[model samples]
Target chain A: MEENNENMTFENSSLAENTAVTAAAVENTENLNAAVENAPDTNAAMENSSAGSPAETDEEQKKPYRKIPKGLLWRCWFIFCFFQRTCQCFDRAYCNAFTYGIMPILRYLYKGREDEDEQIHAGLMRTRNYYLCEQSFSTVVFAIIIGMEEQKANGADISDELIMATKTSIMGPLSGLGDAIHGSTFRQIAIALTIPYCLEGSIVGALLMLIGMNITPWLTTLIGFPQGYKLGSEFVLKLLQSGKMQKAASAAGLMSMFIMGGMAAKYANITLSLTFKNDYKEIKIQDMLDNAIPGLLTIGAVFGFYGLIQKKVSTNKLILGTMAIGIALSACHAMGY
Target chain B: MSSTGITLLVAFILACYYGFYSTYPFMILMGPAGMGSIIGLIIGLIMGDPVKGIEVGALIQTMYMGVVGYGGVLPVDQFFACIIAIPLAISSGMSNESALALAAGFGALGVMIDTLWKTINTSVWTPYIDRACEKNQYRKIAKGAGLYPILTRMAISVPIITVLLFLGSTAVNWLMDNLPEWLQVGFNNMGTILPAMGFAMFVSYIGKKELIPFFIIGFYVMKFASLPIIGMAIFGAFIAWLVAKTDKSSDTEGGLA
Candidate 1:
């Protein structure tokens, strides 16, 4: 039985491969009118080629992508992209159950053989189990990859267990890498670029931020889907070992630091408004400070805040502390002391 | 509708958005609807004073730029903060500084409400999905997972926002009318100091000992050369590229050796 199934798989794959080639050929034919004219001939040829194949029934059953309508797939993408975080209740199973639970929609749409329900359930369970680990930025990528794997599996040869194992193994490294690249590195750079414009009340700045922030996740998910499908479990290791990801992140980090410094000087406002009476002259403290180092107070303020943060001061405490000092200084100023 | 009624209505809508009513995972990429700058712009448009709204929003935005909620932990509730602070600032003619100080306090309050809401959602709403899964009902499961949470979030957000907007405007007006001048000045002063605190928090998140020099360079170029932020960013990118190249070459040599 196993040998028969294997032979059937091989024949079906070869037939599908041929169809894909013909589809490509039809696409590559230049003129629009010529392509249109050739479409019926190509279809006839494809039907003739598949007609002699003994595994035609299997081929019909295996065309899961065709069975799974575009609208259903779109709905799957919508749920995977947006609502995967709905149930954060289970500790190890974070998004796993939610991701697994939604796969039935796609499976039902794929409309495999009547007896294939168990295979579908097993595939869904494996997907659910592998996605047990929690992730933020990479969750969408993981979902897309799993969806592609299910669609491609076609209920034979590629066991649910193998597919599940592939997904489970890659989750850890992908999560860590994604958090570093998307969460820490790219996000900071986006914030630095957008904040200045936001401060200026420029709609352009907000728009820029909206686009910059959304595009990364969107593009990553888009690129990750195909790469994950092609590479399977090897995708995570290839991505991490490539060293390019780290290099990009570090470069972004350095740029972010420079931008942060610029922001500090631009936004961290502190002025020494006090003027001192010196021998035969009135010296403005702020003027002297500016002469010695322009944006002197601004630099000091950033350093001071940095120092406080290094001391592990909580954000709320720092906020309250800053407020107290400001109020005290204002009171002093008001009293003319 | 009265301007206060209009403002509250807008605030309610924003609260629903922030409540993660629909496809919030995608919406989050828009950078948190509750962010001060965005909120300010929205409020500005609603109040018919986009310029002042942006100014106030910018000030508040600086305070929270370094703040991020990861692993279900939010240090402050900027959503609630902006809702209460912006309208009050606009109505009372409050300086940016005072508005910021008020936002910090209100944001902390928002954190509590957010905690309460999330607790209810996880404990109550999440189990419905598990039930649906056991029954093998795909449509039920999808609705339980997707649509149910949105409904719950709306339930939690709408009323709270309405009350805050209605009462907040009255309260801010009262404070403005009754408060002594010194206290008002104190709030104003606190605002100026708060931005430095914001920057400090930001530095802590992205600061590296090796990158300290870049920060210094950025400060000096901005102060001494009086370069705009865009110019500083360009220079920063150039330096980063040079550093990255050198680091790559050295690593390759090290690997070969």
Candidate 2:
């Protein structure tokens, strides 16, 4: 399961294309014919329809390539940011959000074309497939895809398969790292750092926590989008391969581990009530554990659950199990065990 | 301000909070530590006890530290727990244990509500998007995808949370009041123990065997020296930097060889 999920990449474009053709035929055959005629070739036309106006794509191809406008890039960033989780469906997952977010860029690329609608409709339908990843860190993927769209608009040899493959291949590894860094580690560090202050009756704790939580995601999006667009997908692949990404992830992990230890020590306060009567006096287990280590129970709880998690125990099960153990211990205490 | 006005104000805050929750900038307000604390503090101030609000908020935040919306599956809805529990804690003078129990229990319910919201988006709004896409209506697709999901969630969550706040707060207090003493103690103990799960979840995701020593070092240091969290974080950062630097040099050497 882990192996399968780690390298997961969905690519069934032929299926999508077939359905799209049928859907388009049923909806409006005349419009589809107009789109095909305006298109340079059927394949280029199909790819072209998803972006820039196919009619003008030839003219735009002749003109000098202009760098995508700063305003357009900004619009792309904000749209994705705002609508990344929009209209999530059972079928397509994040496809709706992707389509919605990239609309501006698509329109810009396909601008002033006779078959602009058909082209955009094609583009939107192409992205209408399974896509799930850490939202903020997904800026890089969106940027790269936009770059591909721009290139395709300018008559690059980019295929729909290439674009879809890029989206699928990159998103998985990125999501894995993103989930670890932004989703888990960074969030824990923020909470750990701010919780103490929060417990102390200071709004600073809450304020710092908000700042801590927001900064990584905001900065990642801010930096990732522009850099991703400039460097393109090849650069991201290079970064992934260089092992620098691993080193950086490890560094972040190390910090998170240290903080987790500190947090567990300070916060986890489960106490045991087990005792044995030896006639002289009842020997208490909690004291013995404390004598061995101050927060032994807490550490034990952490590692025990960690082991369970590594063994693929679902989080909900672990949560229930922890609650059950806590309840049982309470019952033991009630029974004077 | 009148209690009614305060209730209305809280309702508005919660409405905005949950409505734009998945939207960016608004997404920043999604975390328990961030928005949860703010909401707690706001409700606390409204109740003439900002400190209590902060404390309760912090507690919820701490418990939910490692909870992530991984693959869009939230095992527990800490945000929902926060909105419900903070108000209950402040208004009904509920015990922290009871408040936590309410948070945990209702948190499960919150997940169901979240699923329902997503389902509604899929079922109700998605068809419009598909139709819009087929007909080449860009504006309709944008509105369907971007605007409708949020507004729909607002429509669903706002009324439900607001009603829960006004009516459910006292009712939950009553329920907690009636729970057996042992169960209450069990819940209190559960609250204490739950944060361990947070840390455990934190480590399980990020932990590597090579970094195990850092965890040990961090634990023992905190046990003996009891350094503040910020100080520990700084120390950890320094160690991480050193380790990364050393590892990079070794990698280069390995490549050269």
Candidate 3:
């Protein structure tokens, strides 16, 4: 097990159970050592093998294993794809993480520490898969969480197809989320206003962003983590105290929607164009639309077709329809419409 | 558009990188937080996981992000709704009102649906995910390469953008003519009500019970301090951070007052 640990950067817990496995050392984040602090993270392998709970049950539920039958993936890929296709207006996470992060977390939580090399490998692979494919931020967390869980469980052999299916399923929704959060809102709010100040070369904006976006999120996550931990610890107690999961989902949903609605009103813009009608003649319709309507219209179009393409409308047809609209609009602009 | 304008526009577009071109179909099918495509992607990258993190991250993000139009101010866009998840929804198509509705209704649904799906998956598939928990490096590689959804979207977006580019101006007129009444009213109402809602949510979510001090701090910065928008926001965040760092017990109280 120690030999395997040396060969792999992945976190597997069989070393503790085996006892022969070398304990990978944790960077004593708490140890106040300034000199000779080059201690290796080697003991972590051994310590983790024994203290392996982090590998498992650190988070919530996950997607079904490939080996499992009659689950959501096979039974309802199409249904699930509704959110996958339309995760543009808002940033999504729980479901994607469930399939990716939750999977391994569960695996690790339920099973005893053993060789879970296959599962961890699969989870990480799926995580990277969607980053390029769709560009979501949740994908990595989903995979690691799943990997951690799977490592916790002794780890049973799961098939490639199921894991792949989970990986592929999450790619697009996650990417869209990635674009909206860091790409649009975070980037825009964090830096859009700050860039001018920073561009004029003020370190103020840069520092402001550091605190606004980076520090804010980090702080939120720090607080959130413990809240989540407390929730996890009292899972059964909370369940009994709170009654069914449905009520909680309902409250959370209403709260989430209320928040989402507020965002659309404030940030999603697509106002009319401003231009002179000469060499720069009147602004092109595209410019006109962008300036006049803001981008909310674009969001509308995506949502309008979400139900259609997600189920009945084919991908081919959707693209075809979009092109037809784009061309027609482009032509109108060209022809002075 | 001038070449310069187009260049600038392109840079902006790249920076924002709307996720619809890549993830719509699968999201619509999957019903994760439909709005969380971008966040899911970021969470994925941050976690070194990608889409899977998106699956889970979307749920988490829905709490922090959203869409509100008119006079309302939102912390983020609410693209989680189903209508917005469709291809080209937020691209060059649809009306402002429609987009707002799509984002609002569908984004809300996305959160609900994602929660629903997870609840079911948890109940049904726990044993399965449990089995395959150990494999790591390999899974990450596979997760990175996975592109079925993108391929699927590309297959669709290409035609849509191409066709729309040449379809003519009548489409725009038709779209304008067809604007719905409920939507108009909703947008108007939103303009009036949303600001209150957004600020209130910030107070509620951030405040929980600590509203007075946060509001006082926010008010001080907004009024007396009169810092720039970004500065004021940072000050608010700083205050929030200190408050956040407060012991859970302290945080729960309304305030010293």
Candidate 4:
């Protein structure tokens, strides 16, 4: 399973035109495209919308580019690229995509201002906004684009090992950081700060929510790029240098503190465990004991589910479990049990 | 009081005061059982072109959705931002599309206008939070650095979003309305669904399949049980800890933590 996943991952990560030695490279981008393109509801979008300029894609490599080793497969790349690029797609999709998506909208709104040209380096600002929205989870996107550049730099031979290694090894860690920083920490924390007002049905609340939501990720995404790229390059070089992944995971763990801490502050939830032996009785466990049980219960639920939760559990079920345990036991009166 | 400050305050008040009354988002999601979303693009283009603005709102919900507040420490201070922003946009002529987008930003912008309000808040409040975090260095940093940046962000954001919505929306509308036929179609198509797609991506990415139970628990608490999301969150955490304790002693240390 590990080997299969590794090979599959490597093949999925590789973006160069396909070659001879490792031809059946298990490209998953096509599957990913099919999953997205054939998404239950959102099919039949404009062909143009789902693809970039087809005219520009004619690089004319005779060798096929499939998981298959030998016969030419430009058609597959064309189809996926057409849909994926046109679709403006990505992985670790939510937080990164959200940041990427919003930057452009704000830029679009602001750039249209007649005096936007006068607003603090408009061209650079516009470029920043454009890149942010279009390329929020841009680690892979940029890597793929950079891989193309590497093709130019290294005489375009398509080193399967190098390409596969870079894509598989680098993508998970890069995206993990990407996911943690942008999605979990910055976006979650900021939005956590922001949403109460919007739900409250007040303009002030919405504004607070919006600013809290947008600016953090916007800033994080901007900062994340150089950090991720540098990290990726350094990680590969270090592996090359020492031939070990321990340092890489250690580095990632260190970076995770800031990200996870922020996530803890924002997304972490506690189930309140305040039940009265008798409601009429004036003595309350909370007022008397200062809610220690409830507090402990909160810590228990958050950290307990922490492992299961982080590995990508359905948020819906997590929430439901919280409520079931909350109400069921609150009625039963479990004091941080 | 100088008229400039008063004028700014009133405009801020007018723009954002309605957020307190806007229950539409809560109502929308709180209703449907399955994963449901407000059709932001339809709202944006149909209303104005605040595609980005609406996504901003969606992100706010998702980001905080996972927050588990133990004891009584409420993590976020800007819950009031969205309530303020949405209504102001609509009342001040922001279409539903644009209004939803600009609404949250406007709320924070409103808060920004009244620096006096925040200063009074932070000064009276900061010491308590500061003292609470003495045991943990991270909490200390959180109190000193983390909380205030967001507050300052809100302070500075009011006028910025206000101008963006009331004035900027017009320009955005013009561009969308006036673009060359094919280009306009392209922009409109991309503009509308792209934000929604972005939002769904966030959910799918972070909302992993295994954790569905927790999310469902949260939803259950929020929905059927009628417990406060905070209360349920705490209870959930407690049970999770007990579960962890049981899982431990006999097994390797691996749970939510």
* Top candidate (TM-score): 2
How many clashing pairs per prediction, in order?
1, 5, 217, 128
If ranked by DockQ, best first, what sequence of candidates would result? 2, 1, 3, 4
Tens digits of per-residue lDDT, candidate 2, A45-115, equal 33443344657667655665545798988887777766777677666677777888788888887887677
- TM-score for each predicted model, relative to the true structure: 0.78, 0.81, 0.33, 0.31
Compare candidates 1 and 3 on lDDT and give the better one. 1
* Order of the predicted models by TM-score, top scorer first: 2, 1, 3, 4
DockQ-based CAPRI category assigned to the predicted complex of candidate 1: acceptable
Best by DockQ: 2
Regarding TM-score, does 2 or 3 come out ahead? 2
**How many clashes would you count in candidate 1?**
1
Best by lDDT: 2
The CA lDDT of each predicted structure is 0.61, 0.68, 0.33, 0.33
* Model 1 lDDT at residue B74: 67
Candidate 3 interface RMSD to the true structure: 15.4
DockQ of 2: 0.45
Q: Against the true two-chain complex, what DockQ does each candidate achieve?
A: 0.38, 0.45, 0.07, 0.03
Model 3 CAPRI rating: incorrect
Q: For residue B197, give model 2's deviation from the true position in Å.
A: 1.5
What is the lDDT, from 0 to 100, of the residue A168 in candidate 3?
40
